[model samples]
Target: MQRVIVRSSRGALPTAAKLVAGIGLALTGFFTASAILPYLPAGTRDQGAGLMSMSFGWLIGWRVIGRAPQATMAGAARVGLRAALWLALTVLLYLGALQMMARMLRGRYHGLSEALTDVIAQGLGLGAAAVQLDVIAMLFLGGVLSAILSAWAARRWQ
Candidate 1:
């Protein structure tokens, strides 16, 4: 015989772990975006970029990392690293697509396909410009800190 466990809507209620993780990663995203700003080419304008990144980070932390099964401290660290990479990639893709759209609006691209393809190029260029030694160090440290906090919250609250 086998037993099945079912979860209800009530199970979806927010927990301390989720709140802690979400806020921790959200701060990380905001700081990372701020770090990237100075590296952007002069006259390159961005609106609400920090807010966008923070939202993504919160989503990933709350929905992804928070919901992930608890494990050993080492495993929690891995989850944090994974979340960091996801945040970085998601932000990169978003920025790329945004730049592509801006260029299209200016009639810089000829065709739709060409404009879409340039999204990757634009993202890569931004990554290249933004990824300095200090930025890399901050990102690495921030990810680790967020992970530790989330794991601690899980253990303490559970």
Candidate 2:
């Protein structure tokens, strides 16, 4: 009988670059939320939105941007853009899901399919309503800056 050896590969631990990127994006998320929160229709604004955005930004920064392959400044910028989009989409979906869950709790949605549909619809609506020049500019600038900083940190620390 032959014994076969199996080895599992664990990924590298998180680095300074990840931390820097996460912090950068987290601030970006918080500030962007702040920029738009005031404009939300009365009674519909949730005070926790900024915190939620920060959480999403940190997560995406650590998981998406941080895990991306190290590259040139331009490449880092691209990665940052992608990460930013992911963060935006994640926040949107979460907001939508929250709304759907609230409706479900209220017995507003009669079927699972309807609830799912509502989630998408709500997300689109939220995204549409949230679109503003300040928000876009902040996200774009923040993402690019964070990415560049991340790249620099990677090179500096590694």
Best by TM-score: 1
Please write out the lDDT profile of model 2 over residues 1-23, one tens digit for every residue.
99999775443578878888899
- Which portions of model 2 show Cα errors greater than 4 Å? 1-11, 45-47
Model 2 residue pairs with clashes:
none
Full-model lDDT for every candidate: 0.80, 0.81
List ranges where model 1 is wrong by over 4 Å. Answer: 1-11
Note the clash tally of each candidate.
0, 0
Superposed by TM-score, candidate 1 places the C-alpha of residue 49 at a distance from the truth, in angstroms, of 0.9
Instruction: Tell me how many residue pairs clash in candidate 2.
Output: 0
Cα lDDT of model 1 overall? 0.80
